[model samples]
Target: MSKSVRLGRGVATAGILGMLVSVAVGAAQADEVVKIGEVAPITGPASYLGKDTENGARLAVEEINQKGLVIGGQNVKLELETEDDAGDPRQATQVAQKLVDDKVAAIVGHMNSGTTLPASKIYSDAGIVQISPSATNPAYTQQGFKTAYRVVATDAQQGPSLADYATRTLKVRKVAIVDDATAYGQGLANEFEKKAKADGIVVLSHDATNDKATDFRAILTRIKGEQPDAIMYGGLDATGGPFAKQAKQLGMQQKILAGDGLCADDLSKLAGDAADDVICSIAGAPLEKKGKGEVFTEHYKARFGGNPVLNSPFAYDAVYVIVEAMKRAGSTAPDKILAAMPATDYQGVLGETQFDSKGDLKHGVISLYKYVGGKQTLLDVVKQ
Candidate 1:
């Protein structure tokens, strides 16, 4: 063979090898797996809410994988790394660290305000975007962590909405307040107290309770004696249910007012007949009232064999929001996803979502509910 011809053949072979390497690299990129962490109280008293949150995220993951996800010209597969924080702040931090070690691109939970607050620092330090679907304490986002965000309104909005409903709609004159002493419960109670006092509703008494306490006879007895027209309990349905049931057992007919923690689908089962006398507020609009709410509910029921409770819709929306950020950034890196989050304006099951500078929803809604015949009945929806 001629020397020049041999050199040309060698060059052609090198060009073919380079093209093959490029194709292999593109194929590898197409198979990239993006891990998303979801932390919630999946095993403790708030398990009902936690499981709903997991199911929502799980559903979103399944649908995304099924419909196919492509980011930056590469096919991407999503994997959810779900952890149970058990509703404890300490455990939440541990779970957050685990997710960070696992190198997840983003996180969707830490359902309770207490847990979300502690876990947020871990995510922030790791440069992961942490979106809480249900944590409503104003302090959750007020901690100056750029990674922290929540889809729901804060206790600041929910508390005043509940207080206003108690004063104007329920005609409440004197009210007794009780809180579970956790960040969420106490913060909600504080906001409610501030608003209720400002609205001219006399606070007959203010008391504290623990989230795990089952017996409330002593507090109920005192509040009953005060004869307040209404009682506000700042806690979750796990404890609030029993509190209301016990109050009914004690022959107290006063209406019970509470925040989103007590506003759950399981409240009727937890409080029995006393659920009827309970008025509760959710930090977001009723799922049925949102643009894609009915469809999402039907899909959730069909997939999970039950209706969504509390923040499931929000959780599902959070997943989509994260994915939207990935698409906009054209990358699955955690920092890139976090950078895309601030500009998110995606519309999903809960409606349009946009975050403020503090990572709270730009436009928040509060929904009120009352139990009627062992079912939750919507009373009103207030915008904030």
Candidate 2:
């Protein structure tokens, strides 16, 4: 072919590619589609919780889209994008960057504190609003990030309550703590130790476990010898199940307490009949009364084909909170939503939740729950 003809062919190809690019950009601009990103465990030891969180967020988005997003009446729609961080903090940061690159309007459903903490900074710097449904570490809201928010009680409330039950109720002078060493685990453990010590309970020993650990005989044997009054665990039920069985086999049959991490019916499944005597505390009030959590339960069951795990519905509420803040700000732009979040008060799955100055939930009270007959029964509500 002639050089001029070859050059013309190349130019025509370039023109086609440019047109495709324009079409993509134009489509993005045309959609009044506001994007929300979700990062959850999805594939790791805690995938069950991840799946629940995703369903909650997806359900909220579905309702929002169906209702025709009325933010300034621009004919808005909500588009959901999800990424699996597998409950890893480093992976969570990567996913956060991906969301920022996609230019999502907001994010919800980071289920782990280890993942949520690092990802929060990325959201803060990029001016994206992020609401975590299950991150209970006190430091999560303490980080001073204007964009970070949570819908449940923090571990600061849960840990001490567990400690109180161990000390005052169970009358244990010496105790041991086993933690998974993540932000959630360690933070709650630290609180337990502090409160237990303050209440005149001696901490006999401390141990560590990873999230999916299967063996606890070694730790249980050691704790058994120490003759701790009780053992407080700081991880989720994935590890707590085996921990309970081994503790019973080792004849530690004393009080075993845990935070919200282990407060699920699945935990009862893991511990079997042995879970009956266990005393666990959750970060939020138990779904005890019919009034508060019933609507959320019914709606979630009908839509998601299952029940909300622990506080997964809190994430569903967080999604609405962010979207409502967007409506209040009259913009999906991050800075405006961030500024408007503190003023957002929405009737939600958890309760009528409002954010304090630090963007933490302030409406409902935290309570202590105990396992009995394979069910979580509310023991008491700590009024402090």
Candidate 3:
């Protein structure tokens, strides 16, 4: 019971503490890092849309990291691997292979249907989970691949709903249709054409143009001769905006109908004042009223310096869903992520997100929007 005995006890306690600290540091260093791949048109005309989606995913990653997520008893850090698909199917497949080679845990992109559909096969074969934020083609989900999924409604619902709105609500009898000649454009336009015909609406004309064509004057001039009550354009804002602008130049007063691709805030800037005459259908609930709308909007603007496009919320949700699946599976392997996808019921910035058996959202909501006074406004939300 002297000073020597007390000092020996204190030294022993200090040594134990140092060993524990070293062990803790080693565990932290062993934390697993998972990479999530995002393939979108980060360049070219659709770059804005791609950047919007990428921002959503990037924000989600940052928030998750800040929250100090622990999965499978290990601290996890998520990294984003963004690749530009240029809105091309071939480029999408190339990036898909590259992501597989890079051994990403999952993917949250391939923005357009044309790109998403083709690239999906590569992910499927590689056992990588591919969740499209904006691809709306029903065929993308109908491919029977377990690795494929989407956060938005399909053109199957969006096209018919828009057609019904045109015929019953707007009381339009004659309709003209135009597409951008890509899978997404043609598919949505075809669906609208069929539904419009079945709803007793006369289809005055159907035409085709590429997605990059800035000159829609020729097509608008031809449609002007038809004198249609409404014109449905199955393409993205890049092309749809110019089409609307030219339609205005030709003095066509008919209301413009478009699919989710054209449902963006920048449509007003792209189409100028002609955006007021455009009514577009998006494949999800309005962002401002869903899950964490206002907060997400403020955060997204602060992070990306732009308004949310049609698919940003969906992409945000897609990232959360992937991480949730990773938590459930207790691993970041591609096969495990794909296996956990079918059971996803994630509450995200968008809303309750649950996938059906075919990897499609169960309660897919379609909303109609129109630009009024140079601002995009929601008209209706249709659940399908």
The candidate that achieves the highest TM-score relative to the unseen native structure: 1
Which ranges of candidate 1 are over 4 A from the true structure?
Answer: 1-30
RMSD score of candidate 1 (Å): 10.8
lDDT of 2 by residue, 1-384 (tens): 999999999999999999999766645554487899988989977888888888888888888776667676566778889999998888999999999999998899588999999999999999988998889898988989988888888877778878877877789999989998888888889999999999999898888887768888888888888988788888888888678877887767777788777878667778876687677876665664537478778878998788788766776787899898988998888788888888988876666778888877775466777777777777887743
Task: Give the range of the ten consecutive residues with the poorest summed lDDT in model 3.
Answer: 22-31
Pick the winner on TM-score between candidates 1 and 3: 1
- Give lDDT tens digits, candidate 3, residues 1-384: 899999999999999999999766744765887899998898889888888888888989888876777788888888899999998888889999999999999999889999999999998899899999999888999999998999999999999999999998899999999999989999999999999999999998899999889998888888889889999999988889989988998899999999988888878888999999999998988888765888899988898887777677888889999999988998877888788878888887768899899999899999998888878898999998
Q: Candidate 1 residues 254-350, lDDT tens each?
A: 9999999998877888999999989999998888877699998899999999988877888999999999999999999998998999999988887
RMSD score of candidate 3 (Å): 8.6
Could you tell me every candidate's TM-score relative to the true structure? 0.92, 0.89, 0.91
Q: List pairs with backbone clashes in candidate 2.
A: none
Off by over 4 Å in 3: 1-30
Question: Whole-model lDDT for model 1 versus the true structure?
Answer: 0.92
In terms of lDDT, which candidate is strongest? 1
RMSD, candidate 2, Å:
8.7
Model 3's alpha-carbon lDDT is: 0.89
lDDT, residue 372, candidate 3: 87
